[model samples]
Target: EPEVTQTPSHQVTQMGQEVILRCVPISNHLYFYWYRQILGQKVEFLVSFYNNEISEKSEIFDDQFSVERPDGSNFTLKIRSTKLEDSAMYFCASTRALGLASAQYFGPGTRLTVL
Candidate 1:
């Protein structure tokens, strides 16, 4: 079975630095999304991308955050000027379609740590 994979399983950075999290969604999926869980909090949607453009985004995805497809197989999330609150497990998910019946496949997540 195909699955989403993230790079650098764990990332540590300074509070003012920038970080780029990478993901490779299932080869056949069409829709992609970015979500984050801040420690013990619930999973929060950040943004969704389809057809190479942002389909939707949550308030949490402020100017400091950006998403890009970059190429045919890669999806990425970039966080500028990282903050302490930015430390979380960022997840990448993909689905073939959007609907209640479509299941989203999630990646293991990339743990980001800010100091």
Candidate 2:
């Protein structure tokens, strides 16, 4: 079976430094999303990218963050400046459909460790 892999090299970052975690989801999926889970908390929606633009984002995604698809195969979440509280497990997913008719698919998650 094909496995999901996270490029941790892209996640290494220092506080106040820009960091990006790259995710490559299934090609046929049309909607891309990022969700986070703190060590002791429930999952939270961070942002959604569609049609080459951010279609929806949560309060957690502020001016310091951005999401983009630089190419057909990669979806990225960038933090302009890192903060200690930013540490968490970030999950990336994609779906060919949306809402009720859509089946969601997830990629391997990358953890963010802020110092």
Q: Please report the candidate that would top lDDT against the real structure.
A: 1
* Model 2 ranges with Cα > 4 A deviation: 1-5, 9-12
State every prediction's TM-score relative to the real structure: 0.97, 0.90
> Residue 21, candidate 1: how far off, in angstroms?
0.2
TM-score of candidate 2 against the unseen true structure: 0.90
| lDDT for model 1 | 0.95
Candidate 1 runs further than 4 Å off: 98-100
- State the C-alpha lDDT per candidate: 0.95, 0.83
- Find the candidate with the highest TM-score and give its number: 1
Location of the lowest summed lDDT over 10 successive residues in candidate 2: 1-10
Per-residue lDDT tens digits for candidate 1, residues 16-39, read 999999999999899999999999
Steric collisions counted per model: 0, 0
